[model samples]
Target: MSQEEKKSRNGGRREAEPERREKKPSRRRRRAGISGVLLYVLFIIGVSAFLAGVGWVAANDVLALNKPEHTAIITIADGEKFGNVIDDLKENGIIEHKSFFWIFSVMTKSKDKIAAGTYELNTDMDYRAIITNLGSHSASRQEVTVTITEGMTVAQIFQLLEKSGVSTVEKLNDTAANHDYKFSFLENIPLGKATRLEGYLFPDTYKFYMGQDPLYVINKMLVTFDAKLTEEMRQQILDSDRTIAEIVTVASLIEKETDGTDQGKIASVIYNRLDHPNAETAGFLNIDATIYYVTGKTVTQADYQGVESPYNTYLYKGLPPGPIANPGMVAIRAAMNPDSTGYYYYAMNSKTGLHEYSKTYAEHQQKLASFGD
Candidate 1:
């Protein structure tokens, strides 16, 4: 009886142990599934929050919202890279995020359209408006209008242009000396010094952007010179056995020497001396203005022979290498058409406030000596 009871009890205990192990595993599986579902929900919520935060920051920067009032002058220099411009905007507090703005610029194609110049920008400007404000014709860009008068020297004109903030003197000189301007008048003119385009930069009023390109500034003046010299004027200059350069050089001398009324007579006197090279003047124009052009000061008695520049008419027989100053159309016309006269010498009469012409050096000296009385 004891052996039968022990075997039944052991078999029932083993079956019960298997059922308990299966039930325990089911309960543990339910609990683990619930924990995994909860973690998945939490991860989704965290990701959504992070994306929303990033979107909010990007929107604020694009729309320029919640930014302090800040005004700054952003200068995009000539040949300045767009990356450097973005860095400047970031440094000036005009933009908060450089990478976002750069991406936005690429998307909108604003990087290629933005012009190089000084522009007034503020923090209130959105990314789009900032890009627009820095454009070529934007009103935010500063401009200055300058009027160059007649007879102004190249150096003086460059200085005036620099003072007006149109461009720096160094940039102007470099461009004038090196930039190959496309114009018929500037064709034979070599590129080495700023004075190469001296007489061709016609004087006129011009409106230029602050920090504008030096080539553009110089081209504007050359275009004016081309337009001012009509076809008729050019043909007349070419008809004579002289280059346009020589005519301009003679015109410059006439502009500086004449008292505004005697340009034709002065022109005649100049041609008479040049035509008779072996006369008493001995092929020397002996003009005092040319000496002044060399010395940049009033010519004294010693300067007539002291100065050795090619521009010195006392030293050089023919025309100077180039123009001494920019001449007006009136003086240019006078150079083209000289009055018929045999006068070989002329002197400015201090008493009459006009030039007194003489056919001989003796008469010229007599008139000069009488001016002192």
Candidate 2:
């Protein structure tokens, strides 16, 4: 009786264990499948929402108003209508949709608050650029450059300054003639002759913003020149037994007469000419710079025949009224201490940047003739 009862109970327990394990596995599989289906539905809904937004933005500009870039600083000029302003932004590629910008403008209630003036507008402008630029000013600053060569005349310098947004050279020319510069060299200038400070203004590159004052340019150049021409240099000029004007005058002539190496010696010859009356005929500076000064043009055969100013050494004697052009440091140093040389006649070959120096006129002429090859 006990064996039979034990066998029946064991069989029932075995069947129940198998059924419980199987049911547990089936429940787990069903739960996982339901979770997977829910996740796929959510993914499809997210994709559809994204595509709908893209289409809406493409069709209507109003959605563009909500874009973050709309608040950027985009300036709109005065008296322009909202539509025209929007069109300008669109043309500049700042706004992708016109309707978006209008909606933004209306939502922000800035339609009438917009001011007129120069503006800075860029591509990322969404609603920010429209409203930000609508406020006055935000214009991009422009780049400016000014250049003056080493030997430009005051007139030339003035023209350059004006062109670079400095005051016009004509105004400065008038001021110079009226003794407004007030420098001693300028003070004694004859009524009809040009004004002072022709050579005193140093030449170099300069930069300034648009609408720079004419006086600012003049002061900057003069300050630079004075600073470069230290007290020690001025004393050296006085020691040479020449006034500042005479030193610069001779230096200018030496600059134009000889080619490269002979500048110092050529300067010495000019000093010698001043010392010895016959040196004019012997070494005879016969300088072309004097002609350039008088005629305000380089030498040509016809100018010699035309009426001449006192600056012309061919027709007149001594240095001209002022320096013909701004002289570099080389010419200034040459005038201070000229080279020791007996050679007097000097000529530069037109084709080459070379010079021929001769002790006698015949030798100089021979060198000039030989220069043809």
Candidate 3:
């Protein structure tokens, strides 16, 4: 009875072992399926994270958000390439991720829309704002206020314009020398010299765009001059023996000779010498400032004798070829109406800061000697 029971138990144990082995493989398969599903989910998560990072970077540059604050004058030269502009933006810290910006520009068709100019750009400006600012409109251009003083020469004015970022000196000089302005005053002034329009550019405060065209700049001054010389003054000039050029030349002399106090008195001396050629003066105006204009130096009497030029009034009989400096309205007015006097000679008294006039050469010499001349 015991042997039969042991054999039945052994047979049952063998069958149970096969079932346990089958169950072990099922559990292993379930664990393997679960691990495969977990790995697939992790891969999807990683891909999503990478795409999110890329999107964030693109959005940052496109929106110009979270960028460092910066302001720069972006000068886009004529026919400048878009790639070079992108490089400038990157260099100026106005933009990051230039490739992304370039792609954005291409998509928006902003590359060809940008015009040549100087624009004030800042990091606060979005990509679209930056592109909009680079257009040809006046609103897009940066402005500068320049004051051309009364006594500034054409060369000095051009240099100041260059330093003020209004325009380059080369451009100003080219326009001044070549452009033929249609004006009565400029009609006699020939081309090929920048100083031809020197006496006519009305000195005043002007507002100009950075990188402005030189033609427009010169035209503005010419127009101002045309407006400044009134109809009354023009008619008076026509009625008088002197032409506008001569009056302006005389005014330029008066401007250099005297301060604001005695322009009319100085004009009287000039007219006395020009209208009435005396034996002592020998028809030579003998003004010292004209020599300085030729040599561009502080001329003494010794320096004057050495200088030989049409502009040297000591050597020349009459007025210089053109106005030595652009005269202000006061000097111009003084030239229009001279003081009634017989004075043919004048000398500036350094201590008194005024001119003492004399009728004769001997009296002029005495007055000059009194001033320690």
Candidate 4:
């Protein structure tokens, strides 16, 4: 190598020598000695400086997003991506730090595990709660449920209402029985002198608001029912030229026969027999439901044939004067939509709960006897 190159290499080596010398602490005593006390003093100053710097950075890094003027629910859906969730939290002022959320999600490996749904995120949430809600799935809905069991009379329903703190059952019954009430669906029989509506109370678990009035509760049920019974059903009745009330009356019969299965077929047979139009001058439907209503006690076929009422299809019938009980959509639909068949008589099989369908009356009579009547 040339002299310049040699000198440059020597200079590089010389520069590295000082770094090596500086790397180790000085072991050789100076003319003046450096004591251990001085070293501890330096360490204390350095630590204090470092702590002060950290406190300053943390203080400067802080920022608070203003809260909502009026609190509102913010839903973070299930299986939602972390990036979008951060945006939602920020947008709703539930959170201010994107970095903190991002770091938490990454460190916890929670990217794919975040639940799906409408989460109840509020401004009052702490940072941990905010993260927790985002990571889970549950909808925010206000629903209060009340149950109406099968075969409950309007009076019973009223009692249930009072028990639930909606209103006194007495008041509800009075309202239902009241002729002057605005809800005219009750108290107006199309062709009969029936005292009350028993066969029209649809059974199910009903949902209502906590403080809702009786009228609102009743109206919601009625509206839901009207929607369920399609317009086509109404049209079919109109085409058959049967009054709306008559269809309801038959629907009550089917509803009564149904606590067992084969409900649809048995219901169809009743319509078929009725279609003959006074062939028996009202052969009794002799349905178990009608007897159960009057006596408030369950009856079998043998105990059944003896009772009589205008509502009793067995005693006299074209159709009852009005609905015997509140029939649900299932029974009402059966009445409106009967199966076209040669089935003139049908009876429920007590053992299997299946209907034994027959075209002739004699076969049904034999089956009825076998029913342990």
Candidate 5:
């Protein structure tokens, strides 16, 4: 009876052990499958991150690479936004990828640091280099010195500006006629006229940058004029029963009439003719320079009497529509404070480079004969 019971128990235990071992293998298989799946997911994640890193590095290299050979000029106007500047870079071929440049700029917090100015850039400059350059003002400036002489016409002034490489004649003229300047003297200038600023460009030595905006160059000249025409002088001009325009016109006439040595005397002659006792009969200025100004030629008898432009002082009595040329501080002073000379006529003395004055027509003729005019 003991042997039969022991054999049955052993048989049951063996069967139970086999079932438990089978259960263990199934659990291990399940665990191994889960682990393999987890490892595969981690490997995929690592590969994706590596690809992103490689793309980022490539983008960074492209942004920092320069490919152009020659230099280019980029102008960022005042109040221009960073987005607009990025567009300009794209349009100018300075950057190939505007979206990337914008993104990098934003990430680096450099969008707000850009400055407004004329930049000397090149295709050889990378996006980062261009950004850094635009942030600095003096980095791209090319300064130039220009000396504008007194009694220069608007055309002449522009010619000088063009010659100095400070601006183009077309640009200067356009700016002079259209741009709104910040000055008291410009208040009376007719903005629509082509030659509105003809007489107001003060003749002086000026230092400017090459490739500068034409409006900025014009403003610099106007500021010089404002600075040169002192407060006291302006007050004097106001005290005189003449407008600033009228004074400038008269000064321009005096500047063109004779050399600076006899400016006061010539100014007196102009005033005498304008305010003569018999103004209706003898008020004509009859300035040959005015005729030349109208005809754009040296004064000839045909040109003098043929032209009917308002600038012809021989035809009209008062000052022209505006100044015919730019006048210096000296000429302006002479026009404002003329000598109390009774003479009403003047002619150049070719022998001495001085002028001969006369109170009568006969005396003027005699002096002209003596000067061999």
Candidate 6:
């Protein structure tokens, strides 16, 4: 090539190379801009997805999920594990998801605080509210209060139990007859009677949960009786030279014999008659209450002679075989500590519901004539 032609071509090539470099940079910039736009779009999508996930978790963990309308009872038994409780709650439709509850409990540090009891829960409760309810003591238990009055017979007490829906009469009677109570007072209770533990069921108001076992109710009553019969009372019975059975039997008679005001004097009259050498008429006790106990009705003159049971104190000389009815603390205390009186016979004033005492049959007759029964 000629020198002039080479120089012109080289100059033209250099100018074109500068223009090519500029074009290359512009192409690179266009590609970089497109990549930047794509990266920004991806970042926005990731952020939206993260926000959606957070919203889902909050709805499930904190919000009130699907639940039923009415309240349902859930029994969390003793020593139940948290996993088992969650399973129970889920199975009972109290919660839609166990995982959400588990996560929420973990976050709130309430997994170990769940108490064991019978909880009445409603679907309107949120997860937090339900957790709070289960954790508290008073919110978890359902109780029924039963008031047993003084002098209630075993049959009457069982009837009250059946009426209160605490237990059936058959179940309560069976439990009272067969269940082996651990109380010291129950050690001497004989077996095979119609109502073996008849008078030992302490008369008082009691609070029991619905659907509790019949044995549990019986045990509670017996335990209450044990608690009420303090150590001093037991020692008093021992010092009186009488068995506990004798004292309770006498107390039951005293409870039926008169109004509660003069139990100590009535107890004294009973002791005087029992110790009198020629007191056969009064020593027989001829108690109308025993006849009522046997016949399940008021004692008539014929029933005094015709009744055949050993519980008929009218014919028997000593205390009855067992207590005829449950006596209150007053009668029990009166029996244990009788007043030292000389009276051996007594009659109740029909209008006054009070007793008139006498040392002889003629005096008793004069009192009855005065009272006009």
Score each candidate by Cα lDDT: 0.84, 0.65, 0.83, 0.62, 0.79, 0.79
lDDT of 5 by residue, 63-129 (tens): 5543544334567887988888888777756676777788888888888878877665656666678
Kindly give the stretch of ten consecutive residues in candidate 4 with the minimal lDDT sum: 63-72
> What is the RMSD, in Å, between candidate 2 and the native fold over all Cα?
18.8
Q: Write the per-residue lDDT of candidate 2 for residues 1-373, one digit (tens) a residue.
A: 5767767978845334444544456788899999999999999999999999877875444334444432122335557788988887777556787776787778888788677644444344446545755663322334366776666777777777677665676766765454344344444556543346767777677655455444544656664566577789888877867777777667667656654466787876676665665753542345777676656767774566464676666555556767877776678778888888776667777678676678766888898898885
Clashing pairs in 1: none
Candidate 6 per-residue lDDT, tens place, 1-373, comes to 8777877988845334434433456788899999999999999999999999877755854576443353445667788999999898877667777888898899999988889875656567888888988887652446788998878889999899888888898888777777666556667786554377877889999877766667667767775787799999899888878888888888989988877799999999877777774774656777788888879987677758778889887778867888889998999999988999988888878888778888788988888888865
Residue 69 error for model 2, in Å? 55
Question: Which of the two, 3 or 6, has more lDDT?
Answer: 3
| Candidate 2, residue 37: how far the Cα is off, in Å | 99
Number of the predicted model whose lDDT against the real structure is largest = 1
Cα error, candidate 5, residue 261 (Å)? 0.4
Instruction: Provide the clash count, candidate 5.
Output: 0
Q: Candidate 6 lDDT (Cα, whole model)?
A: 0.79
- Tell me the spans in candidate 5 whose CA falls farther than 4 Å from its real position: 1-135, 277-281
Per-residue lDDT tens digits for candidate 3, residues 76-135, read: 888999999999888877788899889989999888988876565767888888888877
Residue-pair clashes per prediction, in order, are 0, 17, 0, 15, 0, 0
Expressed as tens digits, the lDDT of each residue in 1-373 for candidate 1 is: 4766866978845334444443456788899999999999999999999999999999999999998766566778778999999999998789999999999999998888888776667778999899988885543558889998878888989999999998988999999999777577778989999999888878788878888777767877876787788999899888998778888888988888986888899898888888888888777888887787777889787758878889888878977888988988888899999999999888877798888889998998899999995
Q: Say which prediction, candidate 1 or candidate 2, comes out ahead on TM-score.
A: 1
Task: Report model 6's TM-score to 2 decimal places.
Answer: 0.63
